[model samples]
Target: MLHLRVISPVSRTEDVLAMLRVQPGATHIVLTRGGALDPEGDAVQADLARECADEVVDALEAMGLAHTGAITLEPLDTVISDAATRARRLAPGDPDDTVVWEELIGRTREESTLNATFLAFLTIACLLAAIGIVTDSPVTIVGAMVVGPEFGPLAALAVAIVRRQGRLARRSLLALVVGFPIAMAVTAVGALAAQAAGWLSLERIDEIHQVEFIYEVGPFSLVVALLAGSAGMLALVSSKSAALVGVFISVTTVPAAGFAVVAATVGQWHVAFLSACQLGVNMVGIVVAGVLVLVLHPHRRRAFRGTQGARPDRVW
Candidate 1:
């Protein structure tokens, strides 16, 4: 279930209340007139079943509440009320299958930010992968995969394409184009520094055999990427953290980037190229699959239609 809060202008309060009262999936409605100081309106609240969230939010958006006042949706972790149960029963689909687009947009927008923290996590993940490659440790490589933050922008890019949000598409792409190169460059420099310190050498690069799969891109690579991409996007929409982690570990994006950097640092041009190819293949597969998954979503058509003429600057 989702807890919805709407600040409705005085003139629209009646309409908002009437709409909520009639929604079978909306319950525990509360109205506080003149409760909003910033927007200067009435505060209306209700608990809506997950399946009806998109409908309710779309209706509110149509009423111009998104522009004139505010509309916020939050998840309800625990709802013991019989009304909430009845609301869920009245909803059309299973809660786990429902897609709250506003929630998705907000999450992806935040995750796709190309900020210091993003770079830090990416760099750290790459460095860990570099160590994994040198030590030929699959465990360490998996650890790096779990730590990498690349999936956020990739998922955001998919969401942008499906939603037709040009600005979001550009932002997500920028994060990818900039973040990967920077992280790879930093990892390369660190590998070179370690080489200079006698901790790593060209001979060690040639001696590693267990991790060769990181650079050998084949048909299975694309297959795994496609599957992982679909699962990742589905997990994101469904709010499944454990499934998301599985998606993260399933892809070779971070490991390939790290391997490419390390290979390049050791003057293994062909190996670096192969690793880069693996990275590219994984990213493209994930993005394409993600876009398809989101496009096929049941709520996608309504979301696409609802956003027509919406301010491009507004993400949700």
Candidate 2:
């Protein structure tokens, strides 16, 4: 659920309240008469949601009756009667018409279980891909695609940008910038070691046929990435973990990164560069598409706002 705190001039409190009352999927509403502030205006607190938030807010602004002095939204666990259920409700279902920022990043900061697991999985996926590329194994390459953790950061970064959360965006970008290169480097080193051991050879690693599937970076890849990114965002907004997994599988970030590592290992600089370009292109495409989806999708914002108690209104 979303918790909104609003501060406006005293004269506009009722106007704001009236707007809040009509929002759909708003589970609760709380009001504060006046609060301490500098010279701005009186403070009013609202605990509504995304469903009716934009409409109500837009209406208030259009009416010119309410002037927003300050606004804040905090996510809530539940409006449950029991404290245990409240505490145990980890994954809150998003409001029908709101946007949910938490799903993109996972709830909580600094070492949430999902984040930690994603990192670990990413490492494993990259390692496997490196092995696959060195050995020219299609099976291993596909496996790496299934394992990579790049999708989470990519999705989160898009949501952050759409929601205007600079911190979230920075964190997600940091994960990607640091994560991708590290995965590539590790994969390259692994491939080199495999070559020295005679488990694989530079010629085998550089074979065009092995990773050629991704070499054809054309409109198909762009369209697929766009669609996959849209699916990823929808999964995030809808709390569909299984569909998110499918999204990760559909995108080619891990496979391309792995192919690049294999090429770099043998000093096939040209192919390696091409593969890297492919990876970069796919990454940028998916992320940009995801940001657009989040910006255009209301559920994500409303989920962030927690409008369970508010009245429902049409978003489209």
Candidate 3:
């Protein structure tokens, strides 16, 4: 179920109430006159089954409530009312299949932001990747993959492409572009320092038992990337966030970036080139797979591509 809070202009309160009254899936309707101070409007609240939220929100958006007022959706973790159960049965769709584009837009937009924490995680992941490559440790490489934050923006980009969200696509791309370069550059310098400190050796670059897959770009790499990327998108849309850890470990995104830096530091020009190619291959595989999966999503009721002017959506 979803709980919605809406602030509507005083003049439009009746129109908003009328819409809510007509939605069979909506329950627990409450209204407070002049409840919003900044907007100085009436606040309306309702609970609806997850399957019904998207349509309700789309209708509200069409009514311009999201423009002159505000609409916020929060998941109802617990709903004890018999009315809630009845609403769910009447929603005419599978709750699990519902996309809830509003939620997705907000979530992907937030995740794609190139914040300090995002940069820090990316940098640390690359550093960890460098360690894994030099020591040929599978454990460290997996650790770095799990620590990498690139998946969020990458997923956002995939969603944006399928949904045709230009701003989101651009932001996600910018985050990955800026974040990876900084991280790879730092990893290169760190590799140099580690060599100077006698903690790493160039001789270990090609004499590794593990971590070879990080730079061994091949057809299998694309297969794993495609599978991992699809699973990651499914995890995101279905609220199965725990699956993300496994998806991270399965893909060679951060490890590939780190390997490129470390390979360059060791003066293995061919290895560095291969690592870079590996990164590109994985990205293409993930993006292509993600777009394909999302295109088939049941909840994508509307095709949003090239709709930059359809509605005013917040990029942030």
The per-prediction tally of clashing pairs is 0, 28, 0
Q: For residues 1-316, what per-residue lDDT tens digits would candidate 1 score against the true structure?
A: 8899999999999999999988999999999989999989999999999888988888898898888999999988999999999999988888778888889989999999999999999999999999999998999999999999999999999998888877788889988999999999999899999999987888999899988999999999999999999999999889886899999999999999999999888899999999999999999999999999988887777777767746656543
In the range 81-170, model 3's lDDT, one tens digit per residue, is: 988888888887777677777787788889889989999999999999998888888999999999999888988898888776788998
The alpha-carbon RMSD values of the candidates against the true structure, listed in the order shown, are: 1.5, 8.6, 2.1
Give the candidate number with the greatest lDDT: 1
Q: Which ten residues in a row have the lowest lDDT in candidate 3?
A: 301-310
What is the overall TM-score of model 2 with all chains considered together?
0.64
* Native RMSD of candidate 1 (Å): 1.5
TM-score for all models, in order of appearance: 0.97, 0.64, 0.95
Which parts of model 1 are misplaced by more than 4 Å?
A: 314-316
Q: Could you tell me which 10 consecutive residues in candidate 2 have the lowest summed lDDT?
A: 307-316
- C-alpha-based local distance difference test score of model 2: 0.63
| Deviating ranges (above 4 Å) for candidate 2 | 1-97, 102-119, 206-210, 299-316
lDDT of 2 by residue, 1-316 (tens): 5566667677777776766664443434566566737435556555544344454454544544333475555656555544323322422344543454432345412322235566677778988877766666778877888778777677766765665556667777777777777667767777778878887666675464765775557778878888988887676665556887778767778887777777766777787787777788778888888888876874545544533322232110
Ranking by lDDT: 1, 3, 2
